[model samples]
Target chain A: MADVIKTATRDAYGKALVELGGINDKVVVLDADLAAATKTGMFKKAFPERFFDSGIAEGNMMGVAAGLATTGYTVFASTFAMFAAGRAYEQVRNSIAYPNLNVKIGATHAGISVGEDGASHQCCEDIALMRAIPNMVIINPADDVEARAAVLAAAEYVGPVYMRFGRLAVPRIFDEDYKFEWGKAVVLSEGADVTICATGLMVKEAIEAKELLAAEGISAEIINVHTIKPLDKETILASAAKTGAIVTAEEHSIIGGLGSAVAEAVCESGKGVPVVRLGVNDEFGRSGPAVELLHIYGLDAQNIVAKAKQAISLK
Target chain B: MDAVIRKQLKIKACKARMGIIEGVFNAKSGHPGGSLSCADILTYLYFNHMNVDPQNPKDENRDRFVLSKGHAAPALYSVLALRGYFPVEELKTLRKSDSMLQGHPSVKYTPGVDMSTGSLGQGISAACGMALGAKLGGKSFRVFTVLGDGEIQEGQVWEAAMYASAKGLDNLVAVVDNNGLQIDGKISEVNSPYPIPEKFRAFGWNVIEIDAHSFDEIDAAFNAAAEFKGKPSVIIANSVKGKGVSFMEDQVSWHGSAPNAEQYEQAMSELQQALAELEA
Candidate 1:
């Protein structure tokens, strides 16, 4: 394996916001009293005038982002994923998504990786909630390189976007030269026996799971799906057609995260591939060390390997 | 305010009310009560106060307005049409399947709409954002928003209020149409956001109270808002639930119900008479 580089996606997001601020004078950042936590404080340090602290008002911050977008500004509103996507769901839907404004919602601390804060702070349903809104683009980047690139892509896009980031530092799967594409899945490896589609922090786990499967004489394809909303149906369907079996993994709930998105895509394409979803089953995340929580909730690489074997058996 | 200008504004207000009636009557559904109540305020803002051009609706320098109480879109649509944003004939297509005039204000569909608003308590926050954006961009444009009396019951409104004040958004002005009614009943009974002015004052805003139907007070309030510096302003315009038609005035039943054929005729007749008197 290439020398692993560990960094939180939120760190990349903060650095990206500062870079965007320098490049685009119209870029503005708004935070709801979580500037230091969400990492928008980096942008705040670089450009104090453009950063707006909404003072613990997530819903108002969303409306402000929508309002700023109307005036030709690319507004980045940051907060915890639980608050940005869950608490302010209606504001995001009505104010940002409904208008199709040029607002990028940079939601950090997503999924079970938001350890110690427990289920109240961890957001597993943001992707599902955001996907339901029309004109909303959902992006969940896996590593530092992808997170930074996704921020730039979201800034250039002329509509509302929801970008999810995690709290814990994870293994960097992509190098600095990696380019992020919207609505296009990046195939990490090619195999015909089965496919493992993953997103966000789970992409690293899927990579680890592929090696484990290979050791058992099973070949597995690894596809990193960064954009969940405008799902790369063509790539996903082609992979499903070739592999004829799928194991979807994520650090979110099994009900409505990347797993659900992949299953829906396969079903909609009428590809009869049996998809074994590996994620936190219908349960809330508990307070523990992030890695331990992932293991307890069955969201680790071993879980993905098990699901891949199950999918192969079903096939 | 000059008598001639007041007379013209009254005429425009009457015409705007007529458009509201035309829209709701044709659609067979809409919130006419709140729309009629804020007709005078909308007329004053578009025709007299705001520096907006119908031909250049998307001009970056133009003043922005957000109808925070978006159910009152009929009032905004009527004013925009009268201001030549689109044809007055388009008012009849409101709430239709493919019409640009949606059930709420949509910036994408409607011209002269600064921000798309329908869900209560959100528009003011966007207005704050616009005001802050103007400050950040060093633009001279100002932003204005209108909210309903009952709509202020939303917690988000207070959150936005705190933000506007904390940000010292003097370029932003919020007008609350204190019509005293919502869909259920009187605002007091539904959930009283009473003492509106004091509440805004508590939030560090320069509060201005006015009779929303009076063009003189509406004009003066806006001017006062423009003059205030270092803090946001709120104009609490006390108004009737339904102002123009006699039968509908202050009637909570008219909150979201459209006028029937007989009721529509009565409303049009009343508005036309008012317009004729103003012209005289």
Candidate 2:
């Protein structure tokens, strides 16, 4: 461990917005009255004139973002994942994606990690919903470094992007100098027996599982898939060819998150590599502590280790 | 406004109405009632009020227009064509496969459209964004959008309205085409957004009422919007469901129904007569 620093992805996103605002004068921020919670208030504090509070209206905020994009501004609109990806799905699709507008949707409080809010606030299917929209680039960063880099990358990319951030503060996986590339998975650890592909908060768990598996003499490769929409098929296929077994981990539902995406990629590749998925089985989250919920939903390192073992056995 | 200018606008509007009919008739499915009702407002904006060039549709300094009531794409397509954004003959390809003229206003496919809009109540929010962008950039270009009377029933519309006022977007103007009908029936019978002006006033907007069919009133309302400072303006243009065509006037059936062969001919003949009278 390199003296890991713990911070929420939302906090990194807010800091990145302030940094981007200083670098790019055309960068604008919009939040639906969740500035304090979503951490967009940092941008508001830095540039009050450029920050727009849409007053608890997520759908209208999306449309406004699209409008701003048309006028040569790179817009970052923030809200909870449940509201941004669920309530305003139509607005994002029609206004931003349909036109291929340059709007970055920075959605925080994603998955069951949004503790104490229960199912109504926690979003488990945002990846599925956002992935269905055409011209939408989905980026779910795992740590502070990747989240900050993803925000900067999204600002430069001139199209609709959905960046998922977490409410819970997790350990920093990457260092300051780590280069975040879009659509390219980063291999954190190398193994030969099985591949563990994960996204968002689960990437940290995957690393922990990698250590546990190493102790058990099971070689497991850990890959961080940040961009979920344009999945790094080449990297995943290569890993599958090398390992012949795979396990996917995510804080979302197993039905349509990282697990389904990897499964689809493997099926498309015609690789007979058996895959095990570790995530919340189709169910809503309860009002509990985020760390406890991760354990209850089977999204911890132990679960990943178990799944990797199962995948290797099947292979 | 002089009679010559008014006559020119009238002739142009009549031809645009003819284009609307031609497009819907060819598509075999489109909204004509709201299109016809909003023809004059679209005509005034494209022809007389907006400082836009068809050749430079994407010019950063050019004024932007959004048809928030996007079901009336036939009207906007007609105006954009006559304004030379594309060939007027392309109007026949409206709603056809492999054509740029989609059933709704598409900023990607359409040359002169500033924003893509089909779902109601979202266009005005986009307009507010443009206005806010202009303010942030210290640019002088203005943004205009047209909304349907029934579309105001959407909660998002009110949300955008509140934002526009709070931001002091004086460079934006929204026109509500109060044709009094939606897809179902009368707007009041369905879900009345009555006292529209008061609602806008409550949102802290500079409100104006006008007859949508009158060029002078349309011209004056836009001029007033430009002069008003520190707040966005909303023009509630009272209009007939189908203004020029007598048979379709106030008929909810024409809300989204395209005309048949005979009906198309009847509409063309009536529009041609109106054009002749304006030219005379």
Candidate 3:
């Protein structure tokens, strides 16, 4: 029942970045010798002159991207999220985010979907780390359609932005004509029993959980929190107010990722709603099949549905 | 050097030194040793050598400078302020919150700052990127960066060195302040950065060894850097840790320590006499 939509989010990023390059001459693409892995190959194919392969030096690549961005170039530096957020955090904080350059960091290989590569490559902490930066705008789209829109949005937007994507194929939840807007949450479904706020690949799982809850005569509201930095506080609060209960989900740490963002919003709004967060609880991921990893990490729709049910019991 | 030009350069160097001292003494917390060590070099660049506009700091074709070792923010801030990038009074607010003069250089906050750099060994890479950017954009402007000898220990600095040489970054000039002390201890004890000129030469850079305190050698090094083509050049500026102050000379503890009230008065008096002597 959950196997409805399947498309590589990386494909969306590649296609969208190429389209963005065709229009904006300042939109340059830089890769850390992971062009093929991050699917920035299409950008390289079209704009060979504008594309920069900074070898395997992630730190140097980050500084180079920031430097290029300072010279009026809207640079989209793509690599594994692990390297972009983990390997070059200092550069991102000082050279890029501190100066507020218009550099888009398109980070793929997010979550356990980077299976068989082990925990070393899968960047589950990227969201929390990037969220800590002052001027960084974090974007984690739900699926391919949203991923394409997010990529295009990041290129057009100013300042430093980190757009995280997963390597595994996920459901295409958005339409072809879907447009991406910053700081706006896409309400996939509305309900009164419980509000399920999620980001990145977890948004798709939340949508499936909605169906599972609906079969049990529960109305679960699903909100796709694409922009986690300038979070849509109004929408989140409104859902929490009406639903009286909420559950936040993400493919990141339960500490400072989308779940934490939603919790902060709920706490600030003084809603005191029963908020349940579903994510990796201070644990590293292991190599396995995608579905098995999802279940093992308790991130499947079933787990989310259970969390949502528990939140309703408190409600 | 011509009589009039030499006199003017000496005056500018004195003014730069005065600015450095004033900003550091007022803040009561800043890197005075490194700032004083690089004052002559920064003075030579900002006042007489570099083609920059105080009115237009973002002029694309203007000469660029990245203080790779950005702990010397007081010196750079004073240079920028004295050059009319902002009000000279703002120099008093160094490292204070809400002030443009942060602990490190930031282009977003300060005028005349080409790039914000605090992390050592990273700014050279950024400078290399700027050089590459200039070539790609078909701009003929040259890019210059000043690094610390102690900062060269970071492996990324060598990576940038290799990158600049491989790309034939002739438009880039790197001035290394060969002051022997870092924060912990002397450069030799901390990590020997010996044969600095030869190392750069091996990496395909035209190396120039000069007495950093001598204005003549500083001038000649810039001229030599300009003459070289198809390769980056490094001016290995031999300097004392605290170049001007007698008590602070070659002192590692003075790397970031502010002078006490009594010491501040003495330091100020010394700088004032030095300025007066240069004028005389």
Q: Assess candidate 3 and give its lDDT.
A: 0.87
Between prediction 2 and prediction 3, the one with superior lDDT is: 2
Candidate 2's DockQ is 0.87
Task: List the per-model TM-score of the A chain.
Answer: 0.98, 0.98, 0.97
Looking at model 1, the pairs that clash are none
Across B175-244, the per-residue lDDT of candidate 3 in tens digits comes to 9999999999989998898979889999899999998988888888999898899999999999987777
Badly placed stretches (over 4 Å) of model 3 are A1-5
Candidate number of the best DockQ: 1
What C-alpha lDDT values do all the predictions have?
A: 0.92, 0.93, 0.87
lDDT of 3 at B223: 90
Model 1, range A137-194, lDDT digits (tens) per residue?
A: 9999999999999999999999999999998998888879998887899999999999
Evaluation by TM-score, superior candidate among 2 and 3: 2
Candidates arranged by lDDT, highest first: 2, 1, 3
